[model samples]
Target: MESQSSLQRLLSGPIAPGELAWIGLRPARRASMIPVSAAKLAPGEGLEGDHYISSRNGPRQVTLIAAEDLAAIGQFLAGAGAQPEQLRRNLVTRGVNLLALKDRRFSIGPVILEGAGECAPCGRMEETLGPGGYNAVRGHGGILARVIEGGEVRLGDPIERIEEDISTVLARRRNR
Candidate 1:
């Protein structure tokens, strides 16, 4: 059996906060994304002006990619750097391990987001990233999330993991 400290180390530790490096919104299906400095997120609506807002699915309200992963993808493709627009994700973050936030609620500026799952690479990756684009983005595809509390998220906002219990955070927000 693991000791208390060891268990704690495995379960909880100092959070490495990340930064919101970029934001993009697709205004229409199959359209190129437009970079934005800030955007409003809403429950069940995704980003206010994003094409995904109308998506019937709830778990895919937002998509995020780590800048580090993008760099890795670029290196994997022989210096072919992949841009945020090419990935088709809504947000690009740096320094945080997105997979670590699985099943957890986190704060990105004023917005509260619940991690849903991995945003697997789709067929479009090849068309966007070139020959091995699909394979390049295979494991670096980032994460999907649901908006828990809608609010404005701006470029350069700190992406932080919520240390408090999600229930406690939600309760406090409700009481406010």
Candidate 2:
């Protein structure tokens, strides 16, 4: 079995304009595209929603704030921690396959999500980059998920995988 340290990370783009490239410790499926009525989206408040739309036939795309990175950033800002620079993922996903999360089902806290599609970067990234943000995540798929269950998600929370190997399950279902 691969150690947790061996888990690959996916870097789609930067967090904000003028910010460094953002890396997802584990990229996940973009669920329903529904809007999560969590706390207000602030600069440092974590979660933020943009006007960009991924699927017209699907739900709205809601950007998730990685609780892990937020906690680390918050701690450093509070002067109670010492850590190196870290990549801030918009969505903190677990369990569900980071690469095959789309069109699938997963959960956070107690909420079950209906993975819709990919969260690709847009031209607005260029505005944030002031020059080359558009090219940052050209082919990379950033995560976009609709909140199935609304609950406070903090760092260290587990993104339990309902299916151990999605491909295997899917193949079996198809054969049936």
Q: In terms of TM-score, which candidate is strongest? A: 1
Candidate 2, residues 1-176, lDDT tens digits: the string is 85344233332211121111121221223322332323222222223343232222233333433333334433434533211112223454322334355554554433344455665556654443334444443434335555543444443444543443545544554586
Tens-digit lDDT track of model 1 for 1-176: 95678765765676699989999999998999999999999976689999888875578999999999999999988998989999999999988999887777899997899989999999998898999999999889999999988899998999988989878987987899
CA shift of 165, model 2, Å: 14
lDDT score of residue 105 within candidate 1 = 86
TM-score of each: 0.90, 0.42
Superposed model 2: Cα runs more than 4 Å off = 1-58, 64-90, 93-97, 164-176
lDDT of 1: 0.90
Which consecutive 10 residues in model 2 have the weakest lDDT in total? 12-21
RMSD (CA, Å), candidate 2 to true, equals 13.0
Candidate lDDT scores, in order, read: 0.90, 0.38
RMSD of each: 2.4, 13.0
